[model samples]
Target: MSHVSRSAAVPPDDLSGPLTLDDLENRADKAYARHMETYTAVTVLHRVHMDHAVWNDTASDTLGLAREMVTAYRDVTRKEWYEAYIAWATAAGFEIPADMVNDGTDIPTGAADDPPDHPVY
Candidate 1:
């Protein structure tokens, strides 16, 4: 894992009780940049985990399971972060298969695409 800066999302201090507008702007920039860095890091980790460790010589049925996980996470994040990840994956030639993008529906829980029978390793 890469080491991201652990600094607080606050601006540098000066000889003042509270922050000024400039200080607030600087703090905002810092916070946004930090958020972007963490976002990129998470995208990288997800791709590596999917392509290397999780799906290494894995079966298509198991791959569906992984896609299901990605979709579930996408749902939690309201698909915003997932869209960023999709862009990153596409740029990296990962081509997130269509199966991964789940259709938004109010179906009952635990009722999704079933795994293939006699799934090959």
Candidate 2:
């Protein structure tokens, strides 16, 4: 996995003046990349900890704690990035159509007449 780092400079939160959409998009993109990098690192640490259980338990526990800390950092970074994107989009007057729905599935609108094949439980 590729290494990701957060930018030293973040976009100012002051929305008192006009801001370009392109600039906002660029900031959001950078934030997203940083978040992904942290997330990948945390996942890798977790896998390593689980796979090397034969090693000293004390070392493994320390690594597990590190993974948990990084996971929390990744979650916060992701949320901040999402909020920035939404704020910029709203400031630019980008609106979602009333007819559109986001169900986190690839199924097209009005195309799935039956429920999913698998049970929720």
Model 1: how far residue 21 lies from native, Å: 1.1
Scored by CA lDDT, what does every candidate get?
A: 0.43, 0.57
Q: Which stretches of candidate 2 lie over 4 Å from their true place?
A: 1-12, 15-18, 50-53, 96-121
Error of 1 at 10 (Å): 15
Scanning candidate 2 in windows of ten residues, the lowest lDDT window is 1-10
Q: What shift in Å separates residue 7 of candidate 1 from its native position after superposition?
A: 24
Q: Please, what are the lDDT tens digits per residue for candidate 2 over residues 1-121?
A: 1121222232456855445666666767787677667756765676676667488878878887887787678667766666556655554556733323335443122322223322333
Find the number of clashing residue pairs for candidate 2.
0
Q: How well does model 2 score by local distance difference test?
A: 0.57
RMSD of 1: 15.7
Pairs in steric clash, model 1? none
lDDT of 1: 0.43
